[model samples]
Target: MRKPIAPRTIRGRLLCPRVDTRTVDHLADGLVEIDEQGVIAAVGPAPAGCAVPETVPGTVWLPGFVDTHVHYPQLRVAGRSSGELLTWLERTVFAEESRFADKNYATDVAADLCRRFIASGTTTASIYGSSHPIATAVLFAALDRTGLRAQVGMTLMDRDAPPDLCLEADAALVACEALIARWHGHDDDRLRFCVTPRFALSCTPRLLEGAGRLADRHDLPIQTHLSENPGEIAAVAARFPEAAHYLDVYARHGLCTERSLFGHCIHLSEPEWGALHAAGAAVAHCPDSNFFLGSGVMPLRDTLTRGVRVGLGSDVGAGRTFSMRHIAASAYDASLLRGARVGPEELLWLATAGGANALGLGDRIGHLAPGYDADLVAVQVQVSDPADTAELLDALLFSHATEPVRNVLVRGRRAV
Candidate 1:
């Protein structure tokens, strides 16, 4: 028989999957010690010769998911638009984003976005903010209140976008530098800055180059869309005729790096994939949005074989939900379209550790282990079968927000 632990205690089937993102150890009862710094000190079977304190029944604790791609400004437009990618961006996204020009509107929506992220059990996200500095400030302020970890950036575009969203290349770079100074490592490095150029279409070569330089100066993470739709691809090809391909545009500007995170690399060529892998850049595989928009399914297996890092993304607005679990299950479906199926363990890995690694934050968060932030969520289910762990995991991924996440913790404090 296992002995009891004396310190702060909670009893339930503890599923502490290792950092390797492999098998889970099912501790029928476990103890998790939260250090004073709000980090996980230790997790193990109840220590003998001690008393168990509080027990949470019928719940499993898992590392909170890291969403590598999402748009904070897109929350207002999330499920209302339907059309091709570029069309939706113009008719729905552009108009709604213009509202960010209003400071009050941006503040309210910023709070709303944070609330929605917490509601969906996403403890960390890489977010794209609108072009307005005040709007981005409002977004950051709202996120600061949530105790969540995130990397957010002002959307930088100097051409081919709504007039309200455009800024001169120098001005955009200056604003980016200021934001990095203020929030890049705020809240003990929980909130960070990302160097974001909305996409190739929205940024000229001059702007992309400036953004890349700012990223290098601040050493910030870079994010952008790439080859999401065929039309979008053709347009980029025509726009940058001097470049060999769409990815080459960014490459030429020195935007491709290990810290770069590209969203929806659906239409990448063999050369593009090779360059991405060589540069150690990662892809945020946004499955739901791709399926919803009829964007081509990302070739996950092919990318994996080519040795590129891939993570799940909600791609909100374009994606119907903010839940990374939904992203994980959607990825499974996407895999099936290619005559392959993603196993449950692999999907969980993609949602947590894999995603964290993709964002270049592997060691900081994304596992129930020592030296990692205590960002976690509790999922409970009553089942008669022993395989309920797998069932519960599957249910978490496939169910459309029906499964209750009983509690959420970020940095050892309750978030929900």
Candidate 2:
């Protein structure tokens, strides 16, 4: 007679983030005990006398990546733009997003987006839905079934958008309210509704303020764009004459707070940096998108030195890939261009733990250890047996050679 083994477990070579940039805990052969509630009960060297799943050598188990800023409706348009931000939006982006108004089209995209997330090893994400409420609802429904955690928002825009993509302030707010009521805290808060105001230029003052109020009333996180380009900056300045600067437009309207996540802050003045730090808000640094659009590089070193939180984003359609590894590679290049050396350990941290921290889910995610949610990704590095941490990271994060994700788990549930 065979006795059934107890405790659920997974094992492999592990690189666990302590949520500290200075070091990463690498266990050459490690074990993670997952509990009934799907939290990591214990993680370290595998215990003797306890039979466990066969450990896979050369498979590195790391935290599932948290994508801080991505647009769900813009998936199809990812690699099409060769021009700068505004022109590309008018010529290519708007039309693609407008098609989401069709329910069937939105449904298909929603399903495909979920599969793409799993394939890319993304478990948690902060996503921007299109301006259409029905399309956003379809997306939430799709995500709900797939066990992916996300905070989604219908893009709130009342001006300067194509007619098909624009929703009046009042109407947009109402739709947001409806969405929040249905899915704000679904599945024990695994999914949430965020307040997304597409950026200062596209949203009117009233819409932005209303969005801020809605987020406040529900205590939701906010996501928006910042100083990503020069012309965009000038346009923002022209649109809001009274604003001290571009950041102030959101600040004045109550969008700047500890729970805010601003994307592509590549260009900023001294005061802007100070204010951003003081507000306790975070940035979703999309190096891939910055390079794609020829936007200026974000001063990663200066920003981190100022104690501002940052997370990596695969700002798709604009960023070029769904893989965070690609984003990490681009981030390294960005730092080198700025004369700052950012190694693979820190870039790995940015892609996982840093992103979790930026999105206010640090305690639960960002690391693989006891008391943390069991969201993990197993990547088969190019080098089967790496000599050291640097070698491991080089193959894992920086190299152009693609590494396959062997397995993926979200809260101990296998998504792939």
Note the Cα lDDT for every prediction shown. 0.82, 0.88
RMSD of 1: 4.0
Q: Could you give candidate 1's per-residue lDDT for residues 92-118 as a string of tens digits?
A: 898888899999999999888887777
lDDT of 2 by residue, 162-230 (tens): 988999999999999999999988877788999999999999899999998998999999999999999
**Candidate 2: stretches off by over 4 Å:** 1-7, 48-50, 55-57
lDDT of candidate model 1 versus the reference: 0.82
TM-score of each: 0.94, 0.96
Clashes by residue pair, model 2: 78-317
